[model samples]
Target: MSAIARSTEPRLDSVTCASPAGLHRMAYWEWGDPDNDRVLLCVHGLTRTGRDFDLLAQALQGDYRVVCPDVVGRGRSDWLIDPAGYVVPQYVADMVALIARLAPARLDWVGTSMGGLIGLGLAGAALVSPALRPSRGRWGLDATPDVPLGRMVFNDIGPALDLDGLSRIGSYVGQDIRFASFQQAVDYVHAVSQGFGPHDDAGWAALTEHVFHEQDGQWVKHYDLRIAQPFALQTPDATTAAEALLWRAWDHLPMPALVLRGAQSDILSAETAQQMVSRNANARCVEFLGVGHAPTLRSEDQIEAVRRFLLTA
Candidate 1:
C-alpha cells in the first residue's frame, strides 16, 4: 500500500494506493524521518491538493512524519466517472485505503473543509459508515475498538453551511472554462479567496501553482469541474437534505478535535464556529483575525499555533 510519489523535498518518501473502480492512483507528500512512528495526516480543502501543506510540513520538521494526500479527483489523483461519487463516503473510503497503505499504526489528522468533513465523519460515526469498520484489514464493525485518529484539526469549516457562499460557489460549478492566461486564473482565485487574508505576490504565486493549468497556448484549472456536482445538486428541497447530511456528520464526530476559523470568513461563520467549539468538549478552538474560509497554515503565527497544538495537545 506504499504510495509512489516524487518530490524535491528532503527526508521523505512517496507512495500510491490501488483503489476502487476507476480510482487508481493516490499521490501524497511525506516529510520527516520515515522510521518515526508518529504520523500526522494533513488533508486539504476541496479544490486544493495535498501540497498545500508544504510550508506547514516544513515547519514541523522531525517532530512527526507528516503525510498529505490529494483526495480523488484533485491534484495527482484520478477523477471519478460519476460526479456524485465525490461524496463523503467515497472520500472516507479513500482515506481508509490511504491509511492502510501508510501503515503508520496510529496517526493524527488535519483536514480542511471537505477533508475535515471526512475526518469528522470517520471519528464521530462510531463506525457508522460500513466502510470504516475494518480493523487490522478485517471486518469489525459493531465491535468497538481503538481508532487511529489522534489530534484532529478542522480549518474554516464546521457543521453549519454558509448557504450564500455555498450557493455562490454552486453558480460556477461544472463549468469547464479555461483562462487565456495563468495570471487571469490566479487573479480570479485571489478575488474569490480574498477573505483568506492579504497575500503578497510570492504567496499568491505559490497558491497559484497548486491549482492553475497551462497547456500549450491555453491556461485552465487542473482538477475536474464535476467535483462541483454535489453543491450544484443542492437546490430547493435538496438544500435542506444536504444541510442535514452534513450536520449529522459533524455532530457525530467523537475524537479530540481542533477547529481553526478565519476571522473574516463568511463560510465558517463566527456563531457556527462557536457552536462547533461548544459541540466538541475536548476540541480546542482558535481564530485567525485577518483570514477567512481557511487560515493558510504557513504564516509564522499559524505555524506556531499548529506546532503548539501538535506538540502539547
Candidate 2:
C-alpha cells in the first residue's frame, strides 16, 4: 500500500457514556468530513487503540467518514472504575452511546478481535425485536430506532475462538512493563506482537508508536492492566455460555459480512470461518497467508479486500 500522507491526520473527539459501574468518556479519532453521513466505525482489538486503524482509515476517508475509537481503558479513553466493567456488555453499552452521538443515517462497522464481538452485539441487537431481547435490556442499549449495520468486516475473530489463542493472549495482556527508552519500547512491542504478521521496520515502528506512551520520561503501554480482569476471571462454563450467545448474535446479523482471517491464526481457525459463511448466506470469508492471529489492515492486499467489500453497492 502507498504510504499514508502526512496531511491526512485524524481529528480527535470524545463522548460521555454510561457503563454499568458509572460514566466515562470514550475517545475516538475521526477522519474525513465530519458532515459526511456515511459513517464507518472502526474498533480496535484487545489492548489496542483507535490509532491501530490509521492506515485503513486514511485509505478510505475520501469515500466515508471513518471513526476509530479507543475503547474504554485503552488509548486516550478513561479507565473503568471497576475492573469487572471491562467485559463485552460494558463495551457494547459505550458503543451504543457513541452511535447515538454520531447519529448517522447510514453506518458500517470494521472490528478487530474484541471489536468484532461488539459489532456482532450491535448488529444482533438491531435485528432482534425489543420484546425478544434478553433481560440485559438489549445488551444495555437504549431503545433507539433500528440503526442496522450496513456491512461489517470482522478481522480475525469468530464465535468459536481457539482456546490456545485465548490462553496465549491472556498470558501477557495485562502485564505491566516499562521501557527506559522509545527504542526499547518499540523492541518490546515487536517481541509481543509477532502474530500481527510480518511488517518491515517502518511498519512495526508505526504500530509501536501508537501503543506506547511516554510517562514520567519512561515509556509504558497505553491500556490499564486491569483490562484483563474479565479474561482472567472467566470460567469454563462462562466461556461456553458466552460462545453460545456469540453464535446467536452471529446468526442474527442480517447485513453482508466479510470474515478476514490470518491463515496461521490460532484464534479464528479456518474451520470456524467456513462455518460462519455456511451459517450466514451473506457472509464471505478471506484468508491471508503467512499471518497469524490477525492481519493488520495496513497492507495493500488487506486494505483492498476491506475497501472493495465496504464500497461495493
Candidate 3:
C-alpha cells in the first residue's frame, strides 16, 4: 500500500441527538453507498475521533455501508452541556438516533475501547424487558425500539476493566496541553498511544491529523477537556456495579460477537477476554500478540479479522 491514509473518501454528516440536558449534534463519517441496507457502525475509543476508522472504512466500504461516528465530546461532534452526560448510556442513545436515521435493513457494530462499552449497552438494551426499557423521550427519539445488532466486534474491550489501566488513562486524558507544531502533536500522540502497536511515520500522522486542530496560532486537542470529569468522579462501588451490569448484559446477548484483545492490553485482560467468550454461546475471542489496550484496525491482519467475521462468520 502507498500509505494508510490514502484511500477512498467519506462523506461527513451529523444527526440530532438528545440527552437529559438538551439536544446536541453527533458527527459521523459515511462510506460506501448511502442507500446500502447493510450498515456497519464503527465507534472510536475514549479520546479518539471517527477518522480513526479511515483505513478500515476504506477497506470495507464496498462490502458494507460503513458509518463511523465521533462520539459526543470528541472529534467533530458537539460537546455535551452536562459533563456527566459523557457516559455510555448517552452514547448509546445518540447511536440509536443515528441508527433511526439510517434505517438499515441490517446492522453490525465495531467498537474500540469506550466504543465497545457503548455497543455492549446497546446489545444489552435489546434484551431488556419492555417494562425495563428506557422511555423513547429519554433517547430523544419518538420511536426507537431496541434494534437487534446483527453482529458485534468488541475491539480491545470487555465487560470488566483493569483499574490500573483506567488510572493510567485518567492521568493524561484531560490534561491542558498545546503543541507548538504538527510534529509536536504527533509526538504527543505517539507517547500516549504506544499501545496501538507499530506504525510508520505516515500512520502516526494519520492518527494525529484529526485529533488536533489549529486554534489561535496553536495546535490544541480537538475534544472537550470536560469529558474527563465523569471518569475522575467514578468510585469503586460504581465501577463494580457497572461491571456487574455489563456482565449481565454480555451473558444475555444472542447475536454473534467477536472479542478482539491486545495480548498486552491492560484494559482488557486475557482472563476477561476468555470470560467474554465463555459466557456467551455466540461469542469468540482473538488476540493480537504485541498490541495493548486496543487495536487500530488499520493493519492488514486486524482488518482481515474483522472483515472475515462480519462478512462470513
The predictions' CA RMSDs to the true structure, in order, are 4.0, 4.1, 4.0
Sequence-dependent TM-score of model 3? 0.93
> Runs in model 1 with CA error above 4 Å?
1-22, 129-144, 236-252
**What are the runs in model 3 whose C-alpha is more than 4 Å off?**
1-7, 129-147
Report the lDDT tens digits of candidate 3 across residue range 1-313.
2232233888899999999999999999988887677889999999999999988999888778889999999989999999999999999889988887777767889999999999999878766644223233233234344544589999999899999999999999999889889999999999999999999999999999999999988899999999899999999999999999999999988889999999999999999988898889999998998899789999999999999999894
Residue lDDT tens for model 1, 123-205: 65544654454344232334225444567888877777788767656666567767887788878778777766888988887
**Whole-model lDDT values for every prediction:** 0.72, 0.86, 0.88
Of candidate 1, the 10-residue stretch with the lowest lDDT total is 1-10
What is the TM-score of each predicted model, taking all chains together? 0.86, 0.93, 0.93
Q: Please provide, for model 2 over 141-221, each residue's C-alpha lDDT reduced to its tens digit, 9 standing for 90 to 100.
A: 344444445789999999998999999999999888999998998898788788899999898889989889999999999
TM-score, cand. 1 vs. native = 0.86
Score residue 240 of candidate 3 by CA lDDT.
99
